[model samples]
Target chain A: MSKQEQLQQLLGELKAALPELKEIIVASSDGLPVAQLGESEIATRLAAMAATAHGLGKRIATTTHLGNLVEIVIRGDQAYFIAYAIGDKGILGLTTPAGSNLGLVRLEAQEYARKLAGIL
Target chain B: MEPLKIVITGPVGAGKSTLIRTLSETEVVDTDAIATEAIGKPTTTVALDHGTLRLDGHLLHLFGTPGQERFDFMWEILAEGALGILLMVRADRPETLPVARNILDFIKSRAPVPYVVGVTHLDQPKVWQPEEVALFLGTPLEHTQGLDPRRPEEAVRPLVRLLELIGTNA
Candidate 1:
Protein backbone atom coordinates (compact mmCIF):
# COMPACT_ATOMS: atom_id res chain seq x y z
CA MET A 1 0.00 0.00 0.00
CA SER A 2 2.82 2.38 0.85
CA LYS A 3 5.46 3.52 -1.65
CA GLN A 4 8.24 1.69 0.18
CA GLU A 5 6.28 -1.53 0.24
CA GLN A 6 5.46 -1.23 -3.42
CA LEU A 7 9.13 -0.61 -4.26
CA GLN A 8 10.17 -3.76 -2.44
CA GLN A 9 7.55 -5.85 -4.17
CA LEU A 10 8.54 -4.54 -7.58
CA LEU A 11 12.22 -5.29 -7.05
CA GLY A 12 11.47 -8.72 -5.66
CA GLU A 13 9.45 -9.68 -8.73
CA LEU A 14 12.15 -8.45 -11.05
CA LYS A 15 14.85 -10.46 -9.25
CA ALA A 16 12.63 -13.52 -9.28
CA ALA A 17 12.18 -13.13 -13.02
CA LEU A 18 15.90 -12.74 -13.65
CA PRO A 19 17.67 -15.58 -11.95
CA GLU A 20 21.00 -14.34 -13.24
CA LEU A 21 20.65 -11.16 -11.21
CA LYS A 22 22.88 -11.42 -8.16
CA GLU A 23 21.47 -8.11 -6.92
CA ILE A 24 19.69 -5.05 -8.21
CA ILE A 25 19.53 -1.43 -7.13
CA VAL A 26 16.91 1.10 -8.07
CA ALA A 27 18.46 4.47 -7.47
CA SER A 28 18.04 8.04 -8.55
CA SER A 29 20.14 9.11 -11.50
CA ASP A 30 22.09 11.24 -9.03
CA GLY A 31 22.91 7.95 -7.17
CA LEU A 32 20.80 7.62 -4.05
CA PRO A 33 19.52 4.15 -3.35
CA VAL A 34 15.72 3.92 -3.30
CA ALA A 35 15.18 0.25 -2.59
CA GLN A 36 17.92 -2.31 -3.08
CA LEU A 37 18.55 -5.99 -2.55
CA GLY A 38 22.22 -6.31 -1.62
CA GLU A 39 24.78 -5.33 0.98
CA SER A 40 23.73 -2.00 2.50
CA GLU A 41 27.14 -0.41 2.29
CA ILE A 42 27.80 -1.53 -1.25
CA ALA A 43 24.33 -0.54 -2.37
CA THR A 44 24.87 2.93 -0.94
CA ARG A 45 28.12 3.30 -2.85
CA LEU A 46 26.60 1.79 -5.94
CA ALA A 47 24.06 4.62 -6.00
CA ALA A 48 26.74 7.32 -5.78
CA MET A 49 29.06 5.47 -8.16
CA ALA A 50 26.32 4.81 -10.67
CA ALA A 51 25.30 8.47 -10.64
CA THR A 52 28.84 9.74 -11.04
CA ALA A 53 29.39 7.12 -13.71
CA HIS A 54 26.34 8.43 -15.51
CA GLY A 55 27.66 11.98 -15.32
CA LEU A 56 31.02 10.93 -16.76
CA GLY A 57 29.30 8.88 -19.45
CA LYS A 58 27.14 11.82 -20.42
CA ARG A 59 30.05 14.24 -20.52
CA ILE A 60 32.08 11.87 -22.66
CA ALA A 61 29.19 11.24 -24.98
CA THR A 62 28.50 14.93 -25.44
CA THR A 63 32.13 15.81 -26.14
CA THR A 64 32.59 12.98 -28.62
CA HIS A 65 29.23 13.74 -30.24
CA LEU A 66 28.20 10.20 -29.32
CA GLY A 67 24.63 11.49 -29.04
CA ASN A 68 23.31 10.06 -25.76
CA LEU A 69 24.19 7.11 -23.62
CA VAL A 70 21.65 4.29 -23.44
CA GLU A 71 23.39 1.89 -21.09
CA ILE A 72 26.76 1.31 -19.52
CA VAL A 73 28.11 -2.22 -19.07
CA ILE A 74 31.23 -3.19 -17.19
CA ARG A 75 32.47 -6.75 -17.44
CA GLY A 76 34.61 -8.33 -14.78
CA ASP A 77 36.14 -11.77 -14.48
CA GLN A 78 33.12 -13.26 -12.71
CA ALA A 79 30.45 -10.57 -12.70
CA TYR A 80 28.76 -7.90 -14.76
CA PHE A 81 27.61 -4.48 -13.69
CA ILE A 82 25.14 -3.25 -16.23
CA ALA A 83 23.35 0.04 -15.75
CA TYR A 84 20.37 1.17 -17.75
CA ALA A 85 19.35 4.81 -18.16
CA ILE A 86 15.78 5.04 -16.96
CA GLY A 87 14.37 7.94 -18.97
CA ASP A 88 16.10 11.28 -18.44
CA LYS A 89 17.18 10.47 -14.88
CA GLY A 90 17.32 7.33 -12.69
CA ILE A 91 19.27 4.09 -13.13
CA LEU A 92 18.92 0.40 -12.52
CA GLY A 93 22.13 -1.25 -11.34
CA LEU A 94 22.22 -4.98 -11.98
CA THR A 95 24.90 -7.39 -10.85
CA THR A 96 24.87 -10.66 -12.68
CA PRO A 97 27.29 -13.55 -12.54
CA ALA A 98 29.45 -14.04 -15.57
CA GLY A 99 28.11 -16.23 -18.42
CA SER A 100 24.50 -15.16 -18.04
CA ASN A 101 22.55 -14.66 -21.26
CA LEU A 102 23.44 -11.07 -22.04
CA GLY A 103 20.62 -10.46 -24.46
CA LEU A 104 17.87 -11.64 -22.11
CA VAL A 105 19.39 -9.87 -19.14
CA ARG A 106 19.58 -6.54 -20.95
CA LEU A 107 16.09 -6.80 -22.38
CA GLU A 108 14.57 -7.59 -19.03
CA ALA A 109 16.73 -5.08 -17.25
CA GLN A 110 15.51 -2.33 -19.54
CA GLU A 111 11.88 -3.27 -19.06
CA TYR A 112 12.19 -3.57 -15.32
CA ALA A 113 14.10 -0.29 -15.14
CA ARG A 114 11.33 1.43 -17.06
CA LYS A 115 8.75 0.12 -14.64
CA LEU A 116 10.89 1.15 -11.71
CA ALA A 117 11.30 4.58 -13.22
CA GLY A 118 7.53 5.00 -13.24
CA ILE A 119 7.36 3.93 -9.64
CA LEU A 120 9.84 6.55 -8.59
CA MET B 1 19.93 -0.01 6.49
CA GLU B 2 21.06 2.32 3.75
CA PRO B 3 23.12 5.29 4.87
CA LEU B 4 21.12 8.49 4.94
CA LYS B 5 21.81 10.26 1.66
CA ILE B 6 22.56 13.99 1.98
CA VAL B 7 23.26 16.53 -0.74
CA ILE B 8 25.40 19.64 -0.23
CA THR B 9 24.87 22.41 -2.76
CA GLY B 10 25.38 26.14 -3.26
CA PRO B 11 26.89 28.59 -5.73
CA VAL B 12 30.49 28.53 -6.96
CA GLY B 13 33.07 28.84 -4.16
CA ALA B 14 30.61 28.00 -1.42
CA GLY B 15 32.89 25.44 0.32
CA LYS B 16 30.94 22.28 -0.51
CA SER B 17 34.00 20.07 -1.08
CA THR B 18 35.71 21.37 2.01
CA LEU B 19 32.69 20.64 4.18
CA ILE B 20 32.59 17.03 3.04
CA ARG B 21 36.35 16.60 3.40
CA THR B 22 36.21 17.82 6.97
CA LEU B 23 33.28 15.66 7.95
CA SER B 24 34.04 12.40 6.16
CA GLU B 25 36.60 10.13 7.76
CA THR B 26 37.13 8.50 4.39
CA GLU B 27 39.07 10.29 1.69
CA VAL B 28 36.60 12.27 -0.36
CA VAL B 29 36.41 11.29 -4.03
CA ASP B 30 35.69 14.30 -6.21
CA THR B 31 35.72 15.01 -9.93
CA ASP B 32 37.34 18.43 -10.00
CA ALA B 33 38.60 19.89 -13.27
CA ILE B 34 40.56 23.01 -14.13
CA ALA B 35 38.16 25.78 -14.92
CA THR B 36 38.16 26.81 -18.54
CA GLU B 37 36.31 30.01 -17.71
CA ALA B 38 37.39 32.43 -15.04
CA ILE B 39 36.03 31.75 -11.58
CA GLY B 40 37.58 32.45 -8.18
CA LYS B 41 39.09 28.96 -8.02
CA PRO B 42 41.17 27.31 -10.72
CA THR B 43 39.62 23.91 -10.06
CA THR B 44 35.90 23.25 -10.13
CA THR B 45 33.90 20.13 -9.51
CA VAL B 46 32.61 18.77 -12.83
CA ALA B 47 30.69 15.69 -11.76
CA LEU B 48 29.98 15.07 -8.04
CA ASP B 49 31.77 14.54 -4.74
CA HIS B 50 31.31 11.58 -2.39
CA GLY B 51 32.38 10.72 1.15
CA THR B 52 31.17 8.44 3.93
CA LEU B 53 30.81 8.68 7.70
CA ARG B 54 29.56 6.33 10.41
CA LEU B 55 27.45 7.67 13.24
CA ASP B 56 25.67 5.64 15.89
CA GLY B 57 26.13 2.44 13.86
CA HIS B 58 24.55 4.11 10.83
CA LEU B 59 26.40 5.00 7.69
CA LEU B 60 25.94 8.46 6.17
CA HIS B 61 26.64 9.20 2.54
CA LEU B 62 27.44 12.78 1.59
CA PHE B 63 27.14 13.95 -2.03
CA GLY B 64 28.24 17.41 -3.09
CA THR B 65 27.13 19.05 -6.32
CA PRO B 66 28.91 21.44 -8.65
CA GLY B 67 28.12 25.01 -7.70
CA GLN B 68 27.91 26.26 -11.27
CA GLU B 69 24.46 26.36 -12.78
CA ARG B 70 25.67 24.47 -15.86
CA PHE B 71 25.65 21.36 -13.73
CA ASP B 72 22.15 21.99 -12.39
CA PHE B 73 21.26 18.56 -13.67
CA MET B 74 23.41 17.06 -10.92
CA TRP B 75 21.39 19.04 -8.39
CA GLU B 76 18.29 17.13 -9.42
CA ILE B 77 20.06 13.81 -9.61
CA LEU B 78 21.83 14.19 -6.29
CA ALA B 79 18.74 15.41 -4.49
CA GLU B 80 16.82 12.25 -5.24
CA GLY B 81 15.89 10.19 -2.20
CA ALA B 82 17.96 12.45 -0.02
CA LEU B 83 17.10 12.51 3.67
CA GLY B 84 17.70 16.27 3.51
CA ILE B 85 19.87 18.91 1.90
CA LEU B 86 22.51 21.27 3.23
CA LEU B 87 22.50 24.40 1.07
CA MET B 88 25.96 25.80 1.81
CA VAL B 89 26.56 29.47 1.11
CA ARG B 90 29.46 31.74 1.88
CA ALA B 91 28.93 34.36 4.55
CA ASP B 92 30.98 36.95 2.65
CA ARG B 93 29.32 36.42 -0.73
CA PRO B 94 25.77 37.51 -0.19
CA GLU B 95 25.58 37.88 -3.98
CA THR B 96 25.43 34.08 -4.20
CA LEU B 97 22.30 33.96 -2.09
CA PRO B 98 20.18 33.86 -5.23
CA VAL B 99 22.00 30.83 -6.53
CA ALA B 100 21.68 29.09 -3.20
CA ARG B 101 17.99 29.85 -3.19
CA ASN B 102 17.60 28.42 -6.69
CA ILE B 103 19.35 25.22 -5.69
CA LEU B 104 17.19 24.93 -2.60
CA ASP B 105 14.03 25.54 -4.61
CA PHE B 106 15.08 22.95 -7.17
CA ILE B 107 15.57 20.29 -4.51
CA LYS B 108 12.37 21.23 -2.69
CA SER B 109 10.51 20.92 -5.97
CA ARG B 110 11.62 17.31 -6.31
CA ALA B 111 11.14 16.19 -2.71
CA PRO B 112 9.70 17.83 0.40
CA VAL B 113 12.80 16.97 2.44
CA PRO B 114 14.14 19.00 5.36
CA TYR B 115 17.10 21.28 4.60
CA VAL B 116 19.39 23.80 6.26
CA VAL B 117 21.07 26.87 4.92
CA GLY B 118 24.72 26.53 5.96
CA VAL B 119 26.48 29.89 5.94
CA THR B 120 30.22 29.22 5.77
CA HIS B 121 33.12 31.61 6.50
CA LEU B 122 32.64 31.88 10.22
CA ASP B 123 36.27 32.94 10.53
CA GLN B 124 35.70 35.94 8.28
CA PRO B 125 34.52 39.15 9.90
CA LYS B 126 31.74 41.54 8.66
CA VAL B 127 29.94 38.63 7.04
CA TRP B 128 26.28 37.95 7.51
CA GLN B 129 25.48 35.91 10.57
CA PRO B 130 23.35 32.78 10.32
CA GLU B 131 20.35 34.67 11.64
CA GLU B 132 20.72 37.38 9.00
CA VAL B 133 21.04 34.75 6.31
CA ALA B 134 17.97 32.98 7.58
CA LEU B 135 16.09 36.24 7.29
CA PHE B 136 17.44 36.87 3.77
CA LEU B 137 16.61 33.35 2.62
CA GLY B 138 13.13 33.45 4.15
CA THR B 139 14.00 30.43 6.30
CA PRO B 140 13.68 30.20 10.05
CA LEU B 141 16.75 31.13 12.06
CA GLU B 142 16.80 27.65 13.53
CA HIS B 143 17.34 26.17 10.04
CA THR B 144 20.51 28.11 9.36
CA GLN B 145 23.91 28.09 11.03
CA GLY B 146 27.37 29.57 10.65
CA LEU B 147 30.03 26.91 10.35
CA ASP B 148 33.65 26.43 9.35
CA PRO B 149 33.68 23.77 6.67
CA ARG B 150 37.31 22.93 7.38
CA ARG B 151 36.56 21.95 10.96
CA PRO B 152 35.15 18.48 11.37
CA GLU B 153 33.13 19.30 14.47
CA GLU B 154 31.56 22.36 12.87
CA ALA B 155 31.03 20.62 9.54
CA VAL B 156 29.02 17.80 11.10
CA ARG B 157 26.49 20.04 12.86
CA PRO B 158 24.18 20.45 9.89
CA LEU B 159 24.21 16.71 9.30
CA VAL B 160 23.35 16.05 12.93
CA ARG B 161 20.38 18.37 12.59
CA LEU B 162 19.31 16.64 9.39
CA LEU B 163 19.49 13.23 11.06
CA GLU B 164 17.30 14.49 13.87
CA LEU B 165 14.76 15.68 11.33
CA ILE B 166 14.81 12.31 9.60
CA GLY B 167 14.20 10.57 12.90
CA THR B 168 11.25 12.77 13.76
CA ASN B 169 9.82 12.49 10.26
CA ALA B 170 10.20 8.73 10.34
Candidate 2:
Protein backbone atom coordinates (compact mmCIF):
# COMPACT_ATOMS: atom_id res chain seq x y z
CA MET A 1 0.00 0.00 0.00
CA SER A 2 1.05 3.59 -0.48
CA LYS A 3 2.48 5.41 2.54
CA GLN A 4 -0.59 7.62 2.86
CA GLU A 5 -2.89 4.64 2.60
CA GLN A 6 -0.81 2.77 5.15
CA LEU A 7 -1.05 5.64 7.61
CA GLN A 8 -4.80 5.99 7.08
CA GLN A 9 -5.22 2.27 7.61
CA LEU A 10 -3.16 2.45 10.79
CA LEU A 11 -5.33 5.25 12.15
CA GLY A 12 -8.46 3.47 11.05
CA GLU A 13 -7.44 0.32 12.92
CA LEU A 14 -6.82 2.32 16.08
CA LYS A 15 -10.22 4.03 15.77
CA ALA A 16 -11.86 0.72 15.17
CA ALA A 17 -10.23 -0.82 18.22
CA LEU A 18 -11.54 1.95 20.49
CA PRO A 19 -15.07 3.29 20.05
CA GLU A 20 -14.12 6.32 22.19
CA LEU A 21 -11.16 7.43 20.09
CA LYS A 22 -12.12 11.00 19.19
CA GLU A 23 -9.24 11.94 16.92
CA ILE A 24 -5.91 10.53 15.73
CA ILE A 25 -3.00 12.25 14.04
CA VAL A 26 0.36 11.04 12.79
CA ALA A 27 3.03 13.62 12.14
CA SER A 28 6.75 13.65 11.41
CA SER A 29 9.16 14.57 14.19
CA ASP A 30 9.51 18.00 12.59
CA GLY A 31 5.80 18.90 12.97
CA LEU A 32 4.73 18.07 9.41
CA PRO A 33 1.28 16.53 9.26
CA VAL A 34 1.48 13.05 7.70
CA ALA A 35 -2.05 11.68 8.02
CA GLN A 36 -4.93 12.46 10.31
CA LEU A 37 -8.52 11.41 10.99
CA GLY A 38 -9.74 14.78 12.17
CA GLU A 39 -10.23 18.38 11.08
CA SER A 40 -7.42 19.70 8.89
CA GLU A 41 -6.71 22.65 11.18
CA ILE A 42 -6.48 20.47 14.26
CA ALA A 43 -4.05 18.20 12.43
CA THR A 44 -1.70 21.13 11.88
CA ARG A 45 -1.89 22.22 15.49
CA LEU A 46 -1.66 18.63 16.70
CA ALA A 47 1.47 18.05 14.60
CA ALA A 48 3.30 20.89 16.33
CA MET A 49 1.97 20.26 19.83
CA ALA A 50 2.64 16.53 19.66
CA ALA A 51 6.19 17.05 18.42
CA THR A 52 6.90 19.56 21.18
CA ALA A 53 5.33 17.31 23.80
CA HIS A 54 7.36 14.34 22.59
CA GLY A 55 10.59 16.37 22.59
CA LEU A 56 9.95 17.68 26.09
CA GLY A 57 9.03 14.23 27.34
CA LYS A 58 12.13 12.69 25.80
CA ARG A 59 14.31 15.45 27.22
CA ILE A 60 12.90 15.02 30.72
CA ALA A 61 13.18 11.24 30.55
CA THR A 62 16.74 11.31 29.30
CA THR A 63 17.79 13.89 31.89
CA THR A 64 16.27 12.00 34.83
CA HIS A 65 17.76 8.67 33.65
CA LEU A 66 14.27 7.27 33.16
CA GLY A 67 15.28 5.50 29.93
CA ASN A 68 13.09 6.90 27.13
CA LEU A 69 9.72 8.56 26.71
CA VAL A 70 6.89 6.16 25.92
CA GLU A 71 3.88 8.40 26.29
CA ILE A 72 2.94 11.90 27.37
CA VAL A 73 -0.62 12.40 28.53
CA ILE A 74 -2.47 15.64 29.31
CA ARG A 75 -5.85 15.21 30.98
CA GLY A 76 -8.11 18.23 30.95
CA ASP A 77 -11.59 18.96 32.29
CA GLN A 78 -13.41 17.45 29.34
CA ALA A 79 -10.88 15.56 27.28
CA TYR A 80 -7.56 13.73 27.41
CA PHE A 81 -4.74 14.43 24.95
CA ILE A 82 -2.08 11.79 24.43
CA ALA A 83 1.22 12.17 22.65
CA TYR A 84 2.87 8.82 22.02
CA ALA A 85 6.40 8.50 20.76
CA ILE A 86 6.69 6.53 17.50
CA GLY A 87 10.14 5.04 17.93
CA ASP A 88 12.55 7.99 17.79
CA LYS A 89 11.32 9.84 14.71
CA GLY A 90 7.59 10.56 14.96
CA ILE A 91 4.65 11.26 17.28
CA LEU A 92 1.11 9.90 17.41
CA GLY A 93 -1.47 12.30 18.84
CA LEU A 94 -4.72 10.90 20.12
CA THR A 95 -7.64 12.45 21.94
CA THR A 96 -10.61 10.96 23.72
CA PRO A 97 -13.27 11.67 26.30
CA ALA A 98 -11.97 12.25 29.80
CA GLY A 99 -13.35 8.99 31.26
CA SER A 100 -12.68 6.68 28.32
CA ASN A 101 -10.84 3.40 28.69
CA LEU A 102 -7.28 4.64 29.08
CA GLY A 103 -5.79 1.17 29.37
CA LEU A 104 -7.34 -0.16 26.17
CA VAL A 105 -6.50 3.05 24.28
CA ARG A 106 -2.87 2.85 25.28
CA LEU A 107 -2.73 -0.83 24.37
CA GLU A 108 -4.09 -0.24 20.87
CA ALA A 109 -1.95 2.90 20.52
CA GLN A 110 1.25 1.07 21.43
CA GLU A 111 0.66 -1.61 18.80
CA TYR A 112 -0.21 0.80 16.00
CA ALA A 113 2.59 3.20 16.93
CA ARG A 114 5.20 0.50 16.36
CA LYS A 115 3.71 -0.42 13.03
CA LEU A 116 3.42 3.23 12.00
CA ALA A 117 6.97 3.92 13.05
CA GLY A 118 8.30 1.08 10.96
CA ILE A 119 6.38 2.23 7.90
CA LEU A 120 7.51 5.83 8.36
CA MET B 1 -0.92 47.75 2.27
CA GLU B 2 -2.50 44.42 3.20
CA PRO B 3 -1.36 42.28 6.11
CA LEU B 4 2.37 41.65 5.63
CA LYS B 5 4.06 38.67 7.15
CA ILE B 6 7.66 39.22 8.29
CA VAL B 7 9.96 36.48 9.53
CA ILE B 8 12.11 37.11 12.64
CA THR B 9 15.21 34.91 12.88
CA GLY B 10 18.60 34.81 14.62
CA PRO B 11 20.88 32.56 16.64
CA VAL B 12 20.35 31.54 20.27
CA GLY B 13 20.40 34.50 22.66
CA ALA B 14 20.05 36.87 19.70
CA GLY B 15 16.70 38.35 20.96
CA LYS B 16 14.34 37.06 18.26
CA SER B 17 11.68 36.16 20.82
CA THR B 18 12.39 39.17 22.97
CA LEU B 19 11.82 41.48 20.02
CA ILE B 20 8.42 39.96 19.35
CA ARG B 21 7.43 39.99 23.00
CA THR B 22 8.32 43.65 23.30
CA LEU B 23 6.82 44.90 20.04
CA SER B 24 3.70 42.81 19.65
CA GLU B 25 0.52 44.64 20.58
CA THR B 26 -1.28 41.44 21.44
CA GLU B 27 -0.08 38.70 23.72
CA VAL B 28 2.58 36.73 21.87
CA VAL B 29 1.84 33.04 21.36
CA ASP B 30 5.07 31.12 21.96
CA THR B 31 6.08 27.44 22.19
CA ASP B 32 9.19 27.58 24.37
CA ALA B 33 10.08 24.39 26.19
CA ILE B 34 12.96 23.60 28.55
CA ALA B 35 16.30 23.46 26.79
CA THR B 36 17.69 19.95 26.39
CA GLU B 37 21.23 21.32 26.50
CA ALA B 38 23.19 23.97 28.35
CA ILE B 39 22.57 27.08 26.25
CA GLY B 40 22.95 29.55 29.17
CA LYS B 41 19.12 29.84 29.03
CA PRO B 42 16.69 27.41 30.60
CA THR B 43 14.08 27.48 27.82
CA THR B 44 14.24 27.53 24.02
CA THR B 45 11.69 28.01 21.27
CA VAL B 46 10.70 24.76 19.53
CA ALA B 47 7.85 25.91 17.33
CA LEU B 48 7.23 29.35 15.81
CA ASP B 49 6.14 32.40 17.88
CA HIS B 50 3.15 34.48 16.77
CA GLY B 51 2.50 38.19 17.28
CA THR B 52 0.87 41.03 15.41
CA LEU B 53 0.99 44.81 15.21
CA ARG B 54 -0.56 47.58 13.14
CA LEU B 55 2.09 49.78 11.60
CA ASP B 56 1.59 52.52 9.01
CA GLY B 57 -2.02 51.45 8.53
CA HIS B 58 -0.90 47.91 7.72
CA LEU B 59 -1.14 44.87 9.92
CA LEU B 60 2.29 43.30 10.45
CA HIS B 61 2.39 39.68 11.46
CA LEU B 62 5.58 38.56 13.17
CA PHE B 63 6.64 34.91 13.10
CA GLY B 64 9.75 33.97 15.09
CA THR B 65 11.62 30.72 14.39
CA PRO B 66 13.89 28.85 16.77
CA GLY B 67 17.61 29.52 16.62
CA GLN B 68 18.71 25.94 17.22
CA GLU B 69 19.38 23.94 14.07
CA ARG B 70 17.51 20.92 15.42
CA PHE B 71 14.34 22.99 15.19
CA ASP B 72 15.43 24.39 11.83
CA PHE B 73 12.77 22.36 10.07
CA MET B 74 10.39 25.16 11.07
CA TRP B 75 12.34 27.78 9.17
CA GLU B 76 10.76 27.14 5.79
CA ILE B 77 7.31 26.43 7.21
CA LEU B 78 7.21 29.70 9.12
CA ALA B 79 8.74 31.64 6.22
CA GLU B 80 6.02 30.80 3.71
CA GLY B 81 4.92 33.91 1.79
CA ALA B 82 6.91 36.26 4.00
CA LEU B 83 7.18 39.64 2.40
CA GLY B 84 10.45 40.55 4.14
CA ILE B 85 12.99 39.24 6.62
CA LEU B 86 14.15 40.93 9.82
CA LEU B 87 17.42 39.18 10.72
CA MET B 88 18.25 39.88 14.34
CA VAL B 89 21.83 39.35 15.56
CA ARG B 90 23.35 39.85 18.98
CA ALA B 91 26.05 42.46 18.78
CA ASP B 92 27.48 41.10 22.04
CA ARG B 93 27.95 37.56 20.73
CA PRO B 94 30.18 37.59 17.68
CA GLU B 95 29.98 33.79 17.44
CA THR B 96 26.31 33.89 16.37
CA LEU B 97 26.97 36.01 13.28
CA PRO B 98 27.72 33.05 11.00
CA VAL B 99 24.52 31.27 11.97
CA ALA B 100 22.61 34.48 11.43
CA ARG B 101 24.11 34.70 7.97
CA ASN B 102 23.21 31.07 7.30
CA ILE B 103 19.57 31.77 8.22
CA LEU B 104 19.63 34.71 5.86
CA ASP B 105 21.14 32.60 3.11
CA PHE B 106 18.66 29.79 3.69
CA ILE B 107 15.63 32.06 3.41
CA LYS B 108 17.08 34.25 0.68
CA SER B 109 18.05 31.26 -1.39
CA ARG B 110 14.42 30.23 -1.26
CA ALA B 111 12.44 33.51 -1.46
CA PRO B 112 15.00 36.21 -2.32
CA VAL B 113 12.94 38.74 -0.36
CA PRO B 114 14.14 42.13 0.83
CA TYR B 115 15.62 42.08 4.35
CA VAL B 116 17.28 44.35 6.89
CA VAL B 117 19.73 43.38 9.61
CA GLY B 118 18.78 44.39 13.17
CA VAL B 119 21.87 44.36 15.42
CA THR B 120 20.63 44.02 18.98
CA HIS B 121 22.17 44.57 22.47
CA LEU B 122 23.59 47.94 21.56
CA ASP B 123 23.04 49.19 25.10
CA GLN B 124 25.64 46.73 26.32
CA PRO B 125 29.25 47.85 26.46
CA LYS B 126 31.74 47.04 23.69
CA VAL B 127 29.59 45.64 20.86
CA TRP B 128 29.78 45.78 17.10
CA GLN B 129 28.34 48.94 15.57
CA PRO B 130 25.79 48.84 12.78
CA GLU B 131 28.35 49.82 10.13
CA GLU B 132 30.69 46.96 11.07
CA VAL B 133 27.77 44.55 11.26
CA ALA B 134 26.63 45.75 7.86
CA LEU B 135 30.14 45.09 6.60
CA PHE B 136 30.28 41.65 8.20
CA LEU B 137 26.88 40.55 6.84
CA GLY B 138 27.81 42.08 3.45
CA THR B 139 24.64 44.20 3.31
CA PRO B 140 24.73 47.91 2.60
CA LEU B 141 24.97 50.24 5.61
CA GLU B 142 21.49 51.55 4.96
CA HIS B 143 20.07 48.05 5.44
CA THR B 144 21.45 47.65 9.00
CA GLN B 145 20.50 49.25 12.32
CA GLY B 146 21.44 48.71 15.96
CA LEU B 147 18.81 48.65 18.68
CA ASP B 148 18.14 47.50 22.19
CA PRO B 149 15.67 44.68 21.77
CA ARG B 150 14.38 45.13 25.31
CA ARG B 151 12.74 48.40 24.33
CA PRO B 152 9.70 48.27 22.05
CA GLU B 153 10.39 51.69 20.59
CA GLU B 154 13.93 50.76 19.65
CA ALA B 155 13.02 47.22 18.61
CA VAL B 156 10.47 48.36 16.03
CA ARG B 157 12.86 50.92 14.54
CA PRO B 158 14.72 48.41 12.40
CA LEU B 159 11.48 46.82 11.19
CA VAL B 160 10.04 50.18 10.17
CA ARG B 161 13.26 50.80 8.30
CA LEU B 162 12.93 47.34 6.76
CA LEU B 163 9.44 48.10 5.46
CA GLU B 164 10.88 51.25 3.93
CA LEU B 165 13.81 49.26 2.52
CA ILE B 166 11.45 46.84 0.79
CA GLY B 167 10.52 49.76 -1.41
CA THR B 168 14.15 50.20 -2.54
CA ASN B 169 16.43 47.54 -0.99
CA ALA B 170 14.75 44.53 -2.56
Off by over 4 Å in 1: A1-120
lDDT of 1 at A92: 81
Q: iRMS values in order, in angstroms?
A: 8.7, 7.2
Q: Give a tens-digit lDDT track for model 1, residues B48-78.
A: 8888998766799999998877567788888
Q: List the residue pairs that clash in candidate 2.
A: none
Which predicted model would earn the best DockQ?
2
The CAPRI category of model 2 is incorrect
For every prediction, compared with the true complex, DockQ reads: 0.06, 0.08
- Write model 2 residue lDDT over B38-121, tens digit each, in one string: 677877777777789888787899999888664555787877899899999988887878898998898887767889889888
Question: lDDT, candidate 2, residue B2?
Answer: 84
